[model samples]
Target: MKVDIMKKRRTVLNGKPFSIVDDLTKMDLTERKKWAPQVKQLYDSGTRLRFSGGKWRDSAGKSYIFVFNLTLDKKGGVQKTNFNALDACLSYLDKFSLDDVWRTRNPLSSGFTWTSNIDNIRCRLDFFLISKKLVNKVNDCYFQPPLQSDHHIVILHCDISIEPRGPGYWKFNNSLLLDPAYIDLVNSLISNYSSDPHNSNQNPASFWEGLKFTIRNNTIRFSKLKANDSHIYEKNLIKKIAQLESDSISDENLLRELKDARSNLHLLYKNKLEGIMIRSKARWVEEGEQNSKYFLSLEKRNK
Candidate 1:
Protein backbone atom coordinates (compact mmCIF):
# COMPACT_ATOMS: atom_id res chain seq x y z
CA MET A 1 0.00 0.00 0.00
CA LYS A 2 1.15 3.51 -0.83
CA VAL A 3 0.45 6.48 1.40
CA ASP A 4 0.15 9.76 -0.40
CA ILE A 5 0.93 12.67 1.86
CA MET A 6 0.03 16.13 0.68
CA LYS A 7 2.62 18.75 1.61
CA LYS A 8 1.04 21.73 -0.04
CA ARG A 9 -0.85 24.38 2.00
CA ARG A 10 0.99 23.63 5.23
CA THR A 11 3.66 25.39 7.29
CA VAL A 12 6.57 23.41 8.76
CA LEU A 13 8.24 24.80 11.87
CA ASN A 14 11.58 23.72 13.33
CA GLY A 15 11.48 24.83 16.94
CA LYS A 16 9.17 24.12 19.90
CA PRO A 17 7.21 27.36 19.64
CA PHE A 18 5.13 26.67 16.53
CA SER A 19 2.35 24.20 15.64
CA ILE A 20 1.30 23.00 12.20
CA VAL A 21 -2.06 23.83 10.72
CA ASP A 22 -3.67 22.71 7.51
CA ASP A 23 -4.69 25.37 5.03
CA LEU A 24 -8.14 26.83 5.69
CA THR A 25 -9.16 26.21 2.07
CA LYS A 26 -8.63 22.45 2.49
CA MET A 27 -11.29 22.21 5.21
CA ASP A 28 -14.83 21.45 4.30
CA LEU A 29 -17.62 23.87 5.32
CA THR A 30 -18.55 21.79 8.36
CA GLU A 31 -14.92 21.37 9.44
CA ARG A 32 -14.33 25.13 9.10
CA LYS A 33 -17.35 25.84 11.32
CA LYS A 34 -16.24 23.17 13.77
CA TRP A 35 -12.82 24.79 14.09
CA ALA A 36 -14.16 28.33 14.08
CA PRO A 37 -14.37 28.78 17.87
CA GLN A 38 -10.92 27.30 18.44
CA VAL A 39 -9.47 29.55 15.75
CA LYS A 40 -11.25 32.56 17.23
CA GLN A 41 -9.96 31.69 20.67
CA LEU A 42 -6.41 31.52 19.32
CA TYR A 43 -6.84 34.94 17.68
CA ASP A 44 -8.34 36.44 20.83
CA SER A 45 -5.42 35.14 22.86
CA GLY A 46 -2.97 36.90 20.47
CA THR A 47 -1.67 33.61 19.03
CA ARG A 48 -0.98 33.12 15.34
CA LEU A 49 -3.34 30.60 13.75
CA ARG A 50 -0.53 28.67 12.11
CA PHE A 51 1.63 28.74 15.23
CA SER A 52 -1.10 28.22 17.82
CA GLY A 53 0.13 25.34 19.92
CA GLY A 54 3.21 26.19 22.04
CA LYS A 55 5.85 28.70 23.04
CA TRP A 56 9.60 28.20 23.25
CA ARG A 57 11.73 29.69 26.00
CA ASP A 58 15.37 29.19 26.80
CA SER A 59 17.00 28.58 30.17
CA ALA A 60 17.86 32.28 30.41
CA GLY A 61 14.17 33.23 30.24
CA LYS A 62 14.51 34.37 26.64
CA SER A 63 11.75 33.48 24.17
CA TYR A 64 12.68 32.33 20.69
CA ILE A 65 10.83 31.93 17.41
CA PHE A 66 11.72 29.98 14.26
CA VAL A 67 10.13 30.13 10.84
CA PHE A 68 11.65 27.80 8.25
CA ASN A 69 11.05 27.27 4.57
CA LEU A 70 8.01 29.53 4.34
CA THR A 71 6.12 29.92 1.09
CA LEU A 72 6.77 33.43 -0.14
CA ASP A 73 7.40 35.39 -3.32
CA LYS A 74 10.74 36.38 -4.88
CA LYS A 75 11.08 39.44 -2.70
CA GLY A 76 10.66 37.39 0.48
CA GLY A 77 7.18 38.85 0.93
CA VAL A 78 4.39 36.56 2.15
CA GLN A 79 1.41 36.50 -0.17
CA LYS A 80 -2.11 35.37 0.63
CA THR A 81 -5.58 36.25 -0.58
CA ASN A 82 -7.03 36.47 2.92
CA PHE A 83 -6.39 39.73 4.72
CA ASN A 84 -7.09 38.01 8.02
CA ALA A 85 -4.36 35.45 7.40
CA LEU A 86 -1.85 38.17 6.53
CA ASP A 87 -2.88 40.27 9.52
CA ALA A 88 -2.61 37.30 11.87
CA CYS A 89 0.91 36.52 10.62
CA LEU A 90 2.09 40.12 10.86
CA SER A 91 0.50 40.70 14.24
CA TYR A 92 1.99 37.56 15.68
CA LEU A 93 5.43 38.62 14.44
CA ASP A 94 4.93 42.09 15.89
CA LYS A 95 3.82 40.70 19.24
CA PHE A 96 6.72 38.27 19.54
CA SER A 97 9.33 40.82 18.32
CA LEU A 98 10.70 38.62 15.56
CA ASP A 99 12.69 39.71 12.54
CA ASP A 100 13.77 38.15 9.23
CA VAL A 101 17.47 37.36 9.46
CA TRP A 102 18.03 37.53 5.72
CA ARG A 103 16.25 40.83 5.24
CA THR A 104 17.92 42.35 8.26
CA ARG A 105 21.36 41.42 6.96
CA ASN A 106 20.89 41.89 3.24
CA PRO A 107 18.15 44.43 2.76
CA LEU A 108 19.13 45.15 -0.86
CA SER A 109 19.71 41.53 -1.92
CA SER A 110 17.55 39.94 -4.64
CA GLY A 111 17.77 36.28 -5.55
CA PHE A 112 15.73 33.14 -5.95
CA THR A 113 15.78 30.16 -3.62
CA TRP A 114 13.50 28.14 -5.88
CA THR A 115 12.88 27.83 -9.60
CA SER A 116 10.60 25.95 -11.96
CA ASN A 117 11.62 25.81 -15.60
CA ILE A 118 8.38 24.24 -16.77
CA ASP A 119 6.33 27.03 -15.24
CA ASN A 120 9.00 29.67 -15.93
CA ILE A 121 9.01 30.67 -12.30
CA ARG A 122 11.84 31.72 -10.01
CA CYS A 123 11.44 33.05 -6.51
CA ARG A 124 13.03 33.32 -3.11
CA LEU A 125 10.55 31.25 -1.14
CA ASP A 126 12.80 29.94 1.64
CA PHE A 127 13.68 32.13 4.63
CA PHE A 128 14.46 32.10 8.32
CA LEU A 129 12.59 34.17 10.88
CA ILE A 130 14.14 34.35 14.31
CA SER A 131 13.54 36.22 17.54
CA LYS A 132 15.18 39.64 17.71
CA LYS A 133 17.07 38.54 20.80
CA LEU A 134 19.10 36.11 18.71
CA VAL A 135 19.77 38.54 15.89
CA ASN A 136 23.19 39.50 17.25
CA LYS A 137 24.15 35.83 17.40
CA VAL A 138 23.57 35.38 13.68
CA ASN A 139 27.03 35.31 12.07
CA ASP A 140 25.93 34.89 8.48
CA CYS A 141 23.12 33.66 6.25
CA TYR A 142 23.45 32.63 2.63
CA PHE A 143 22.20 30.34 -0.11
CA GLN A 144 24.00 27.16 -1.13
CA PRO A 145 23.84 24.82 -4.10
CA PRO A 146 20.99 22.33 -3.94
CA LEU A 147 21.21 18.62 -4.54
CA GLN A 148 18.44 16.74 -6.34
CA SER A 149 16.00 19.59 -5.84
CA ASP A 150 14.82 22.75 -7.53
CA HIS A 151 15.25 24.77 -4.34
CA HIS A 152 18.53 26.14 -3.11
CA ILE A 153 19.72 25.32 0.39
CA VAL A 154 19.62 28.14 2.95
CA ILE A 155 22.50 28.19 5.41
CA LEU A 156 22.51 30.01 8.73
CA HIS A 157 25.69 30.47 10.69
CA CYS A 158 25.39 31.49 14.33
CA ASP A 159 28.10 32.29 16.81
CA ILE A 160 28.21 30.18 19.95
CA SER A 161 30.88 30.49 22.59
CA ILE A 162 32.86 27.39 23.42
CA GLU A 163 36.10 26.43 25.08
CA PRO A 164 39.10 27.24 22.94
CA ARG A 165 41.76 24.70 22.06
CA GLY A 166 45.35 24.93 20.85
CA PRO A 167 46.15 24.40 17.19
CA GLY A 168 46.80 20.80 16.23
CA TYR A 169 49.63 19.41 14.12
CA TRP A 170 49.58 20.09 10.41
CA LYS A 171 50.19 17.39 7.84
CA PHE A 172 51.79 18.12 4.48
CA ASN A 173 49.73 17.27 1.42
CA ASN A 174 51.54 14.75 -0.80
CA SER A 175 49.50 16.00 -3.78
CA LEU A 176 51.75 19.06 -3.99
CA LEU A 177 54.52 16.79 -5.26
CA LEU A 178 52.38 16.17 -8.34
CA ASP A 179 52.84 19.76 -9.48
CA PRO A 180 55.95 20.32 -11.62
CA ALA A 181 56.19 24.00 -10.65
CA TYR A 182 56.21 23.09 -6.95
CA ILE A 183 58.93 20.52 -7.48
CA ASP A 184 61.07 23.05 -9.41
CA LEU A 185 60.60 25.69 -6.74
CA VAL A 186 61.62 23.28 -4.00
CA ASN A 187 64.67 22.22 -5.97
CA SER A 188 65.70 25.83 -6.53
CA LEU A 189 65.33 26.58 -2.84
CA ILE A 190 67.54 23.61 -1.91
CA SER A 191 70.17 24.58 -4.47
CA ASN A 192 70.21 28.19 -3.30
CA TYR A 193 70.55 27.15 0.38
CA SER A 194 73.43 24.78 -0.41
CA SER A 195 75.27 27.42 -2.46
CA ASP A 196 74.96 30.10 0.19
CA PRO A 197 78.21 30.50 2.22
CA HIS A 198 76.16 31.44 5.30
CA ASN A 199 74.38 28.06 5.21
CA SER A 200 77.68 26.26 4.28
CA ASN A 201 79.21 27.51 7.54
CA GLN A 202 76.86 25.21 9.48
CA ASN A 203 77.71 21.54 10.21
CA PRO A 204 76.21 18.70 8.14
CA ALA A 205 73.45 17.86 10.70
CA SER A 206 72.58 21.52 11.27
CA PHE A 207 72.59 22.20 7.52
CA TRP A 208 70.22 19.28 6.92
CA GLU A 209 67.88 20.49 9.72
CA GLY A 210 67.86 24.05 8.42
CA LEU A 211 67.17 22.84 4.89
CA LYS A 212 64.27 20.72 6.11
CA PHE A 213 62.79 23.70 7.99
CA THR A 214 63.05 25.91 4.89
CA ILE A 215 61.35 23.29 2.74
CA ARG A 216 58.60 22.74 5.32
CA ASN A 217 57.78 26.45 5.53
CA ASN A 218 57.69 26.81 1.74
CA THR A 219 55.56 23.69 1.43
CA ILE A 220 53.04 24.97 3.98
CA ARG A 221 52.77 28.34 2.27
CA PHE A 222 52.40 26.74 -1.16
CA SER A 223 49.70 24.36 0.02
CA LYS A 224 47.73 27.15 1.68
CA LEU A 225 47.82 29.29 -1.48
CA LYS A 226 46.84 26.33 -3.65
CA ALA A 227 43.97 25.37 -1.32
CA ASN A 228 42.60 28.92 -1.33
CA ASP A 229 42.74 29.07 -5.13
CA SER A 230 41.02 25.70 -5.43
CA HIS A 231 38.28 26.81 -3.05
CA ILE A 232 37.59 29.96 -5.08
CA TYR A 233 37.71 28.03 -8.34
CA GLU A 234 35.27 25.41 -7.05
CA LYS A 235 32.81 28.07 -5.88
CA ASN A 236 32.91 29.79 -9.25
CA LEU A 237 32.40 26.49 -11.06
CA ILE A 238 29.39 25.62 -8.90
CA LYS A 239 27.77 29.00 -9.49
CA LYS A 240 28.43 28.71 -13.21
CA ILE A 241 27.01 25.20 -13.30
CA ALA A 242 23.84 26.30 -11.50
CA GLN A 243 23.34 29.21 -13.87
CA LEU A 244 24.00 27.02 -16.90
CA GLU A 245 21.54 24.42 -15.70
CA SER A 246 18.91 27.09 -15.19
CA ASP A 247 19.42 28.64 -18.61
CA SER A 248 20.27 25.59 -20.72
CA ILE A 249 16.65 24.79 -21.40
CA SER A 250 16.48 27.67 -23.87
CA ASP A 251 19.99 27.46 -25.31
CA GLU A 252 21.70 24.40 -26.81
CA ASN A 253 25.18 25.90 -26.38
CA LEU A 254 24.73 26.22 -22.64
CA LEU A 255 23.93 22.52 -22.38
CA ARG A 256 27.35 21.53 -23.63
CA GLU A 257 29.07 23.93 -21.23
CA LEU A 258 26.99 22.55 -18.43
CA LYS A 259 28.10 19.00 -19.22
CA ASP A 260 31.73 20.10 -19.31
CA ALA A 261 31.38 21.97 -16.04
CA ARG A 262 29.75 18.95 -14.38
CA SER A 263 32.51 16.69 -15.63
CA ASN A 264 35.15 19.02 -14.20
CA LEU A 265 33.37 19.13 -10.84
CA HIS A 266 33.05 15.37 -10.81
CA LEU A 267 36.76 15.02 -11.46
CA LEU A 268 37.57 17.47 -8.67
CA TYR A 269 35.45 15.54 -6.17
CA LYS A 270 36.90 12.24 -7.34
CA ASN A 271 40.42 13.49 -6.72
CA LYS A 272 39.54 14.88 -3.29
CA LEU A 273 37.73 11.71 -2.22
CA GLU A 274 40.64 9.61 -3.40
CA GLY A 275 43.04 11.70 -1.31
CA ILE A 276 40.80 11.34 1.78
CA MET A 277 40.56 7.55 1.31
CA ILE A 278 44.33 7.33 1.00
CA ARG A 279 44.84 9.31 4.19
CA SER A 280 42.21 7.28 6.05
CA LYS A 281 43.80 4.01 4.91
CA ALA A 282 47.19 5.25 6.01
CA ARG A 283 45.88 6.13 9.48
CA TRP A 284 44.13 2.76 9.75
CA VAL A 285 47.27 0.91 8.80
CA GLU A 286 49.17 2.77 11.52
CA GLU A 287 46.59 2.34 14.30
CA GLY A 288 44.58 -0.77 13.37
CA GLU A 289 44.54 -3.91 15.53
CA GLN A 290 46.98 -6.60 14.51
CA ASN A 291 46.36 -10.24 13.41
CA SER A 292 42.63 -10.24 14.02
CA LYS A 293 40.39 -12.15 11.62
CA TYR A 294 37.52 -9.69 12.11
CA PHE A 295 39.77 -6.73 11.34
CA LEU A 296 41.13 -8.49 8.27
CA SER A 297 37.63 -9.21 7.05
CA LEU A 298 36.57 -5.64 7.59
CA GLU A 299 39.60 -4.43 5.69
CA LYS A 300 38.78 -6.77 2.78
CA ARG A 301 35.19 -5.58 2.78
CA ASN A 302 36.30 -1.96 2.64
CA LYS A 303 38.65 -2.79 -0.23
Candidate 2:
Protein backbone atom coordinates (compact mmCIF):
# COMPACT_ATOMS: atom_id res chain seq x y z
CA MET A 1 0.00 0.00 0.00
CA LYS A 2 2.81 2.43 0.87
CA VAL A 3 4.63 1.59 -2.35
CA ASP A 4 1.47 2.05 -4.39
CA ILE A 5 0.76 5.42 -2.76
CA MET A 6 4.32 6.57 -3.30
CA LYS A 7 4.17 5.66 -6.95
CA LYS A 8 0.88 7.44 -7.46
CA ARG A 9 1.77 10.57 -5.44
CA ARG A 10 5.01 10.93 -7.34
CA THR A 11 3.14 10.69 -10.61
CA VAL A 12 0.61 13.26 -9.38
CA LEU A 13 3.13 15.89 -8.24
CA ASN A 14 5.89 15.56 -10.83
CA GLY A 15 6.27 18.51 -13.19
CA LYS A 16 3.00 19.87 -11.92
CA PRO A 17 2.42 23.07 -9.97
CA PHE A 18 1.85 22.39 -6.27
CA SER A 19 0.27 24.41 -3.54
CA ILE A 20 1.74 24.36 -0.07
CA VAL A 21 -0.78 23.05 2.39
CA ASP A 22 0.71 23.89 5.74
CA ASP A 23 -2.52 23.10 7.44
CA LEU A 24 -4.47 20.10 6.19
CA THR A 25 -7.60 21.38 7.88
CA LYS A 26 -7.78 24.24 5.36
CA MET A 27 -9.36 21.86 2.86
CA ASP A 28 -12.62 21.81 4.81
CA LEU A 29 -14.52 24.89 3.66
CA THR A 30 -17.86 26.26 4.99
CA GLU A 31 -16.30 25.71 8.43
CA ARG A 32 -13.17 27.75 7.67
CA LYS A 33 -15.07 30.37 5.63
CA LYS A 34 -17.05 31.12 8.79
CA TRP A 35 -13.78 32.42 10.31
CA ALA A 36 -11.42 33.32 7.45
CA PRO A 37 -10.59 32.47 3.86
CA GLN A 38 -8.83 29.16 3.47
CA VAL A 39 -6.61 27.90 0.66
CA LYS A 40 -8.89 27.30 -2.31
CA GLN A 41 -6.04 25.91 -4.42
CA LEU A 42 -2.26 25.96 -4.46
CA TYR A 43 0.55 24.61 -6.65
CA ASP A 44 4.17 24.60 -7.76
CA SER A 45 4.13 26.37 -11.11
CA GLY A 46 6.77 27.34 -13.61
CA THR A 47 5.42 30.92 -13.66
CA ARG A 48 4.99 33.09 -10.57
CA LEU A 49 1.74 34.99 -10.27
CA ARG A 50 2.13 38.55 -9.10
CA PHE A 51 -1.02 38.71 -7.09
CA SER A 52 -3.15 41.38 -5.48
CA GLY A 53 -5.49 39.21 -3.47
CA GLY A 54 -7.34 36.83 -5.77
CA LYS A 55 -6.11 38.69 -8.82
CA TRP A 56 -2.69 38.46 -10.50
CA ARG A 57 -0.72 40.65 -12.92
CA ASP A 58 2.22 40.25 -15.24
CA SER A 59 4.82 42.45 -16.91
CA ALA A 60 2.64 42.62 -20.05
CA GLY A 61 -0.15 43.81 -17.74
CA LYS A 62 -2.21 40.69 -18.36
CA SER A 63 -3.94 39.11 -15.37
CA TYR A 64 -1.59 36.56 -13.83
CA ILE A 65 -3.43 33.35 -13.04
CA PHE A 66 -2.75 31.82 -9.65
CA VAL A 67 -2.29 28.08 -10.13
CA PHE A 68 -2.92 25.59 -7.37
CA ASN A 69 -2.66 22.02 -6.15
CA LEU A 70 -3.23 19.58 -8.98
CA THR A 71 -2.60 16.68 -6.63
CA LEU A 72 -3.04 15.88 -2.93
CA ASP A 73 0.69 15.93 -2.01
CA LYS A 74 2.74 19.08 -2.73
CA LYS A 75 6.30 19.45 -4.01
CA GLY A 76 9.21 20.17 -1.55
CA GLY A 77 12.21 18.61 0.43
CA VAL A 78 13.14 16.93 3.68
CA GLN A 79 16.29 16.69 5.85
CA LYS A 80 17.39 16.49 9.49
CA THR A 81 18.76 19.83 10.60
CA ASN A 82 19.02 20.82 14.25
CA PHE A 83 17.89 24.06 15.86
CA ASN A 84 21.14 25.65 14.81
CA ALA A 85 20.25 25.00 11.18
CA LEU A 86 16.80 26.35 11.90
CA ASP A 87 18.37 29.48 13.38
CA ALA A 88 20.61 29.85 10.38
CA CYS A 89 17.67 29.54 8.01
CA LEU A 90 15.86 32.33 9.87
CA SER A 91 18.90 34.59 9.75
CA TYR A 92 18.94 34.01 5.99
CA LEU A 93 15.44 35.45 5.65
CA ASP A 94 16.17 38.33 8.02
CA LYS A 95 19.07 39.28 5.76
CA PHE A 96 16.32 40.45 3.42
CA SER A 97 14.46 42.02 6.36
CA LEU A 98 11.69 39.46 5.76
CA ASP A 99 10.64 38.16 9.15
CA ASP A 100 7.39 38.69 11.00
CA VAL A 101 6.09 40.48 7.96
CA TRP A 102 2.56 39.89 6.75
CA ARG A 103 2.48 39.59 2.97
CA THR A 104 -0.17 38.65 0.44
CA ARG A 105 0.29 37.27 -3.05
CA ASN A 106 -3.40 36.61 -3.08
CA PRO A 107 -6.29 38.32 -1.30
CA LEU A 108 -7.36 35.31 0.75
CA SER A 109 -4.00 34.41 2.31
CA SER A 110 -1.29 36.34 4.10
CA GLY A 111 1.32 35.21 6.59
CA PHE A 112 4.54 36.35 8.17
CA THR A 113 7.53 36.48 5.86
CA TRP A 114 8.66 33.44 7.83
CA THR A 115 6.81 30.70 9.69
CA SER A 116 8.15 27.85 11.81
CA ASN A 117 6.36 24.58 12.41
CA ILE A 118 7.52 24.35 16.01
CA ASP A 119 6.89 21.54 18.46
CA ASN A 120 8.25 20.48 21.87
CA ILE A 121 9.65 17.05 21.08
CA ARG A 122 9.03 18.63 17.73
CA CYS A 123 10.79 15.61 16.21
CA ARG A 124 11.61 18.28 13.65
CA LEU A 125 10.84 21.93 13.14
CA ASP A 126 9.70 22.65 9.59
CA PHE A 127 11.09 25.91 8.16
CA PHE A 128 9.65 28.20 5.50
CA LEU A 129 9.99 31.81 4.27
CA ILE A 130 7.82 33.78 1.84
CA SER A 131 9.48 36.71 0.09
CA LYS A 132 7.82 39.81 -1.33
CA LYS A 133 11.18 41.24 -2.24
CA LEU A 134 10.92 39.02 -5.29
CA VAL A 135 7.24 38.71 -5.62
CA ASN A 136 5.97 36.04 -8.02
CA LYS A 137 9.00 33.99 -7.11
CA VAL A 138 9.07 30.67 -5.35
CA ASN A 139 10.32 31.56 -1.87
CA ASP A 140 12.53 29.31 0.26
CA CYS A 141 11.34 25.94 1.39
CA TYR A 142 13.50 23.18 3.01
CA PHE A 143 11.88 19.93 3.89
CA GLN A 144 13.20 16.62 5.21
CA PRO A 145 11.62 13.25 4.62
CA PRO A 146 10.72 10.75 7.28
CA LEU A 147 11.29 7.04 7.35
CA GLN A 148 10.04 4.22 9.56
CA SER A 149 7.21 6.40 10.89
CA ASP A 150 8.90 9.74 10.34
CA HIS A 151 7.17 12.69 8.72
CA HIS A 152 9.11 14.52 6.01
CA ILE A 153 8.80 18.28 5.78
CA VAL A 154 8.74 19.78 2.29
CA ILE A 155 10.97 22.71 1.39
CA LEU A 156 10.78 25.04 -1.63
CA HIS A 157 13.19 26.82 -3.92
CA CYS A 158 13.21 30.58 -4.47
CA ASP A 159 12.81 30.21 -8.21
CA ILE A 160 9.61 28.19 -8.06
CA SER A 161 6.68 29.47 -10.16
CA ILE A 162 3.00 29.88 -9.42
CA GLU A 163 0.61 27.72 -11.44
CA PRO A 164 0.70 28.51 -15.12
CA ARG A 165 -2.61 29.67 -16.42
CA GLY A 166 -3.59 30.13 -20.08
CA PRO A 167 -1.28 30.29 -23.12
CA GLY A 168 2.25 28.95 -23.12
CA TYR A 169 3.89 28.85 -19.65
CA TRP A 170 7.23 30.58 -19.34
CA LYS A 171 10.15 28.21 -19.04
CA PHE A 172 11.27 27.83 -15.41
CA ASN A 173 14.47 29.65 -14.54
CA ASN A 174 16.66 26.69 -13.71
CA SER A 175 19.65 28.95 -13.19
CA LEU A 176 17.85 31.43 -10.98
CA LEU A 177 19.24 31.01 -7.48
CA LEU A 178 18.90 33.93 -5.12
CA ASP A 179 21.71 33.88 -2.61
CA PRO A 180 20.21 33.50 0.82
CA ALA A 181 21.82 36.69 2.02
CA TYR A 182 21.93 35.41 5.58
CA ILE A 183 24.67 33.12 4.33
CA ASP A 184 26.52 36.29 3.44
CA LEU A 185 26.53 37.25 7.11
CA VAL A 186 28.02 33.94 8.20
CA ASN A 187 30.51 33.98 5.38
CA SER A 188 31.25 37.63 6.12
CA LEU A 189 32.05 36.83 9.72
CA ILE A 190 34.14 33.88 8.70
CA SER A 191 35.76 34.97 5.41
CA ASN A 192 36.19 38.74 5.88
CA TYR A 193 38.45 37.85 8.77
CA SER A 194 40.47 35.41 6.67
CA SER A 195 43.61 37.52 6.90
CA ASP A 196 42.99 38.61 10.48
CA PRO A 197 42.22 35.59 12.58
CA HIS A 198 41.44 37.66 15.65
CA ASN A 199 38.25 39.24 14.31
CA SER A 200 35.98 36.22 13.95
CA ASN A 201 36.73 34.58 17.26
CA GLN A 202 34.45 35.45 20.16
CA ASN A 203 35.77 36.64 23.52
CA PRO A 204 34.38 33.41 24.96
CA ALA A 205 32.65 35.48 27.63
CA SER A 206 31.90 38.29 25.22
CA PHE A 207 31.05 35.77 22.56
CA TRP A 208 28.47 34.10 24.73
CA GLU A 209 27.40 37.50 25.96
CA GLY A 210 26.65 38.31 22.36
CA LEU A 211 25.39 34.85 21.57
CA LYS A 212 21.81 36.05 21.59
CA PHE A 213 22.77 38.95 19.41
CA THR A 214 24.58 36.69 17.01
CA ILE A 215 21.95 33.98 17.02
CA ARG A 216 18.80 36.06 17.05
CA ASN A 217 20.11 39.32 15.66
CA ASN A 218 18.81 38.90 12.14
CA THR A 219 17.02 35.59 12.33
CA ILE A 220 15.20 36.02 9.07
CA ARG A 221 18.48 36.50 7.32
CA PHE A 222 20.25 33.44 8.69
CA SER A 223 17.29 31.13 8.44
CA LYS A 224 16.97 31.82 4.76
CA LEU A 225 20.66 31.18 4.41
CA LYS A 226 20.30 27.88 6.18
CA ALA A 227 17.35 26.91 4.05
CA ASN A 228 19.25 27.53 0.83
CA ASP A 229 20.49 24.63 -1.28
CA SER A 230 23.59 23.10 0.32
CA HIS A 231 25.29 22.21 -2.96
CA ILE A 232 25.49 25.89 -3.88
CA TYR A 233 26.73 26.86 -0.42
CA GLU A 234 29.36 24.14 -0.47
CA LYS A 235 30.54 25.14 -3.93
CA ASN A 236 30.81 28.81 -2.97
CA LEU A 237 32.57 27.96 0.27
CA ILE A 238 35.19 26.02 -1.64
CA LYS A 239 35.70 28.93 -3.99
CA LYS A 240 35.90 31.48 -1.18
CA ILE A 241 38.26 29.29 0.80
CA ALA A 242 40.54 28.97 -2.18
CA GLN A 243 40.49 32.72 -2.81
CA LEU A 244 41.20 33.49 0.84
CA GLU A 245 43.99 30.95 1.07
CA SER A 246 45.62 32.59 -1.95
CA ASP A 247 45.25 36.04 -0.43
CA SER A 248 46.49 34.74 2.90
CA ILE A 249 49.88 33.84 1.41
CA SER A 250 50.39 37.33 0.00
CA ASP A 251 49.27 39.04 3.20
CA GLU A 252 51.95 37.37 5.35
CA ASN A 253 54.80 38.77 3.14
CA LEU A 254 58.16 37.08 2.34
CA LEU A 255 59.37 37.39 5.92
CA ARG A 256 56.53 35.11 6.97
CA GLU A 257 56.21 33.22 3.70
CA LEU A 258 57.84 30.04 5.00
CA LYS A 259 55.92 30.32 8.26
CA ASP A 260 52.67 30.99 6.39
CA ALA A 261 53.27 27.96 4.20
CA ARG A 262 53.61 25.73 7.23
CA SER A 263 50.57 27.34 8.82
CA ASN A 264 48.58 26.89 5.66
CA LEU A 265 49.49 23.24 5.47
CA HIS A 266 48.49 22.80 9.12
CA LEU A 267 45.13 24.42 8.49
CA LEU A 268 44.58 22.11 5.57
CA TYR A 269 45.56 19.16 7.71
CA LYS A 270 43.34 20.30 10.56
CA ASN A 271 40.36 20.73 8.26
CA LYS A 272 40.85 17.47 6.39
CA LEU A 273 41.58 15.76 9.69
CA GLU A 274 38.84 17.59 11.60
CA GLY A 275 37.40 14.30 12.70
CA ILE A 276 40.74 13.31 14.28
CA MET A 277 41.35 16.76 15.81
CA ILE A 278 37.92 16.91 17.40
CA ARG A 279 38.63 13.59 19.04
CA SER A 280 42.03 14.72 20.36
CA LYS A 281 41.11 18.29 21.31
CA ALA A 282 37.95 17.12 23.15
CA ARG A 283 36.31 19.91 21.17
CA TRP A 284 35.90 21.07 17.61
CA VAL A 285 39.08 22.93 16.66
CA GLU A 286 38.56 26.52 15.56
CA GLU A 287 39.97 26.13 12.04
CA GLY A 288 41.25 29.72 11.71
CA GLU A 289 42.22 31.13 15.09
CA GLN A 290 42.96 28.04 17.11
CA ASN A 291 44.90 26.32 14.35
CA SER A 292 46.77 29.50 13.44
CA LYS A 293 47.71 30.14 17.05
CA TYR A 294 48.80 26.54 17.51
CA PHE A 295 51.20 26.81 14.57
CA LEU A 296 52.52 30.25 15.59
CA SER A 297 53.32 29.02 19.09
CA LEU A 298 55.03 25.93 17.66
CA GLU A 299 57.08 28.07 15.26
CA LYS A 300 58.16 30.26 18.21
CA ARG A 301 59.26 27.21 20.22
CA ASN A 302 61.30 25.91 17.29
CA LYS A 303 63.00 29.24 16.84
Tens-digit lDDT string for candidate 1 (45-131): 533223221122333333333232234333223432344443554565686565667768876655566666555555665566566
Model 1 has how many clashing residue pairs?
Answer: 0
List the global CA lDDT of all models.
Answer: 0.58, 0.34
lDDT of 2 by residue, 155-266 (tens): 3545543477674322222122254555565556544434455534756676545544543445545544553744464444434433332221334364255344435444
User: How many Å off is the CA of 281 in candidate 1?
Assistant: 5.1
| Alpha carbon lDDT at 44, candidate 2 | 20
Candidate 2 lDDT at 252 equals 39
TM-scores of the candidates in the order shown: 0.54, 0.17
Candidate 2, superposed: residue stretches over 4 Å from native: 1-30, 37-136, 139-142, 147-149, 157-303
